[model samples]
Target: MKSKIKAAFNPRTWWPKAKDGMHNMSPLVAFFLLNLFLVWIKTYINYLVNFNLGVTGPIQNFLLVLNPIPTAIMLLSIGLYFRGKLSYWLIWIFNLIQSLWLFANILYYREFTDFLSFGIMGSGSATGNNLGKSIAAIIHPTDYLVFLDLVIILVFLLLRKIKIDRKGIQKRYAILTILLGLILVFVDFGIANVDRDGLLDRSFDNNYIVKYLGLNEYALFNANQTYQQSNTRKKAGPKDLQKIQQFVKENHSPANVSYYGTEKGKNVFVIHLESFQQFLIDYKVDGQEVTPNLNAFYHDQHTKSFDNFYNQVGQGKTSDAEMMQENSLFGLNSGSAMVKYGASNTFESMPGILGQMGYTSAAFHGDVATFWNRNNTYKSFGYNYFFSKEFYPNANKPSYNVGYGLKDKIFLKDTAQYLQQLPQPFYAKLITVTNHYPYDLDKENISFPATKTGDNTVDGYVQTAHYLDQAFGELMDYLKKAGLYDNSMFVLYGDHFGISENHQPAIAQLLGKDKVTDYDLGEFQKVPFMIHSSDLDGGIDHTYGGEIDMMPTLLDLLGVPTNNMTIFGHDLLSAQNPQIVVFRKGGWVTPKYMKYNNHYYDTQTGEELYLSKDKELAKEAKANDAYADKVLSDSDKVITGDLLRFDKRTDFHKVNKKNYDYSKKATLKALKRSQETNPSSVLAKNDGHSTTDEYTTDAPEYSSSSK
Candidate 1:
């Protein structure tokens, strides 16, 4: 009876015994440790995604407290359960694999592309070396921490193998390790869920942890508040709708305008020149000019060049520009909204609108349709056909350049031919790539006269711009020869400002300036949006406008009714109060000579801009933020395939019952269908392929470095 009592009281009777400190560790403990490590890595990555430390303030303290506890417990438990095996070579291998995975995740978080070759061997500021240096700097601390953590873990495991040996000691150590691990697990799970409810709420904390260490609780709270605010849309009163109806009726009424040859039946030719800036127009070399053809063409055509246009280039860059121009949507602050919401096909795009209006919509580009997940977007947007590099057999394949595809000249030529062949009254969107980076035009092949020397990138861009201009001229000439010039309307704009400092600096040098300052820099993004016709009286309308305004403006010109759509832009030809051109940099520069950059600015003096005491700016900011949120949330739906089931027959009664008007709900439903049916509709020109094929190519490969 005394022996039985002694055995029951002994630690070895109930707990697993080991001679060394790590002997009692289990496989389950190891598995838990691995998962905890993964969670920590995920949390770190989330931080990078949420805030640019250079931009946003450091994450709150509470969030950092949530990650390490689980990991410590799991590690301790594993060490106890597998004390004998933990010292084996397999443990080392496991640690090595985990370290590699951590490194890979960090690289992925930094968006390092394996396919792209950096020209680090080059001898220029824009060289691959310089670009690589910049990228390294941006991803430094986070990547280094991952490496350091891996090294530390490896060393700790190695030390454990060497320090412990006796069987009796291992048994005692394992029991202690298990006890400690259990305590930690309880504390971690308890603290983590103290104020949280269910998995969704807990998941929000995970997301928050990604944004900042020790700030998950604060992030969760903020996110919840934001979510609530986002779902609440201000009801557009009857008076507001009536005002919009009246505005549309007055200017777009078919009988009110001059009956020019440019009519509703005319085909539309739109060109989105990649990184084509207005700087090219004035750039000169020696005694000759950089873009003589463009300069002359702009002068010849009835061009409406804005002296103060700005680009809102967001995280998506070219894709964002495409979204703004085609769908009249705003650029999102949270990553790539197109990729996020692309699956559901939510927005009613220009192609779809044109398609409904009996226009055979087509898109043309010099690169692969899959480059930006454009193939899916184009189809979703209602394009009848897409002509990419794959379709252009006669394209010149250049060497040394990373982005090899058809030249803009060939693209333009093929596009013109295709437009002519297509059934009449078509809408053709032509995207040019000649001005894109790694600008590698040979001097011998340059058709334009050169004025600059030494700067190859600038020279190449100038040459390409010249070629594009010539192509544009030729297309215009073809239209005239085909008797389509008078009837068709052509709109040309740049996708964004040129990414080349060499090109920008060359232009500055030509203009006898160090840098193109202030409003001029803004105008650099503002390319010429020309509308030329032999019959319509051509004159510049000095009304302020933006890419977002393009859709409504075009619809207005064509006498089409834009029913119940929430567009961020207004028609330039109409009296729609003061105009505001918002930049992706969060600047709100108005045509009324007001410049805002998170704060207000006086355009003339370049002073810090501020809101009125009555919170006018705050109200506007809130509205804009809400709008941006909606765009992102809606896009999320598209990317996740939430809108795939939506059809014309889908009832909007429930949505309308929530206080959102029937028209608004119907518009949302239509947008969802568009996203589901044409995932790449907003940016990529579709070829009317199967929906399955569209989604299959929806995964986009982003460039490793900023051009």
Candidate 2:
């Protein structure tokens, strides 16, 4: 018995010999197994890199663990139908291509920390050079293991150890392989369904799809969705537009009488605070204010501040926030809406609406316009001018930039010239950097020293937030000096959370929380949203709002009726506005309760409550869920189906994408055209000059040249 047990355990003795009839593998079978092994290795590597699965139990873990098997099997099954060397080489080529695809994604995921999307692939030419230069940094020594099977198979074939079999598997074997793959896929879905109800129909996150399905499966699914949306858009009619319009009108919240049109006709200045969280506002580290200027602005008499404003962003992050704020539309559940559908979708955006009101709009950011596909998206949004990094001074200098673009100070200073050149009552968005992730700063730029949280990320966050505050202060001073301050309606909102869960423990310690709970994580996601107008009443409002609410609220204050547009959010300042804010993920917060993944919690205390036991609470939560789901679905229908193309009666004008261009030369062309078309424009009236030329800054990289 002992000898038998030892023999069974011994890999060398128990190894199936080639001379054995059933144990020997044909070329086709060997190829299939090799491909399967490589795919499993790819899956393991993916699991190691992407830590966002949020797998809770053994079932979920198993589902993610086993996801790649069926994808590989299904893909490799194609070779089964072919015969002879064609089958053998075809499978080998497939395996090689699959390995390359997996390897490429690993590198891409390392840098972007995101799954490669159709949008990224479609726009590869635009970003290829930049990505190519940094490929070395993204490659890990262990990544080469994906090619081990290919290397081994090639060596064996070359050495004549494994001869190519002329005979292919019969049709029965092909059917069996396909059946087996389908059965495995079904098993995967079963586990995923039990772990996450409504997995296929409602799992909007690409990460979730990739976690449960393999990358190939996700790619196929995403491609199908893209195609389906295109096909739907092609078939959509006026009835669909009317249906969406009716829904929007029925759900619309009337603006508050007092706040409505409060800042009408004012120049709109939107400051996008990159990676700024609400916790940074008024936060002190070692008795030193982390963001003094922003704290003061939050408390300013003219600023209407929302302490509970959540950033409802998905994978697109900053771009998603921008889309929501500009269009009163929720971003796509996966991939950036701007990148995915920006070129095609019609928007009744703030810039276009304000353009009808004699305002010329522009966006100022110190990064290349190509990033986030903003170049095309902004054009679709009706911006007359887009001053990307090409227009910024010293944009080519490495020291002037960190992370995504130029430091906030230099960006603000450099963009002043272009900002002043725009027509009066202009709608402009200034996106600030320096406070973004990997929050690093030059020693001289650091105003606040590292905190005592024993977390460098948290400490760096404090310093960068402080720097951003000072940069914003400079912008305010410029606006004031240029006489644009009092007449401009200002909006300051953080794009999203800076500190993710990995740094939440240290952040919780800094926030005086005893421990980081799910509630604490949710709270940490809050971002500051403030509206400032000189004549408006200002105070802290505890209303729950999100990026989706920005456009509606702003348009309401600007006296633009939104009845013609399909708006998903309400004027947050309106007493009638639904106070419920739904996050991109399946989480929502109302005045009384917070619902996260169907789990309910007390809004005030964050105490957990069971939904099954609480009858009234359960009903209320169910109603909210239904409403939220309907809103998202309707929004998706409009975007995915391109319902706006059918609208004829609505005040929202269809944009002619051809009218706008995003080239560096386009800015100059637009500036010249505006001078000719609108003689009273700020630039035309200022004698073809820019008032911002007078603006001065203490930034080390600051240049006075307007060119």
Best by lDDT: 2
Q: Alpha-carbon error at 134 in model 2, in Å?
A: 9.3
**In model 1, how large is the Cα lDDT of residue 696?**
14
Candidate 1 residues 1-707, lDDT tens each?
Answer: 99976865564554334457543643334433564465455445644452322122222234344443333433434434443444433344544444454454344333321101111111122223323433443354655554564466566656763333222223444455556656654554454455332323322112233323222232334455444433423322345434433443442312223421234776787878777776677666555566665566455545544444456655455777787777766544333444434433445677777776666677787666555556666655666667766555555444311243566555655555445445557788888776665455655446666445455445566666766666566565655655566667777777776533214466566556676543434444565555444444445555556676677667666666544444555655555424666555434555544433233445555554345553765576555544433333343333233232232322111111122111324433643454455444322233433222111110012122311
Q: Which window of ten consecutive residues has the lowest lDDT sum in model 2?
A: 8-17
lDDT of 2 by residue, 350-415 (tens): 888788778888999898888777888887888877888888768889998887789998898878
RMSD to the true structure for each prediction, in A, is: 13.2, 5.9
lDDT for model 1, please.
0.49
Q: Against the true structure, what is each candidate's TM-score?
A: 0.57, 0.85
At residue 213, give the lDDT of candidate 1.
25
Residue 701, candidate 1: Cα error in Å is 29
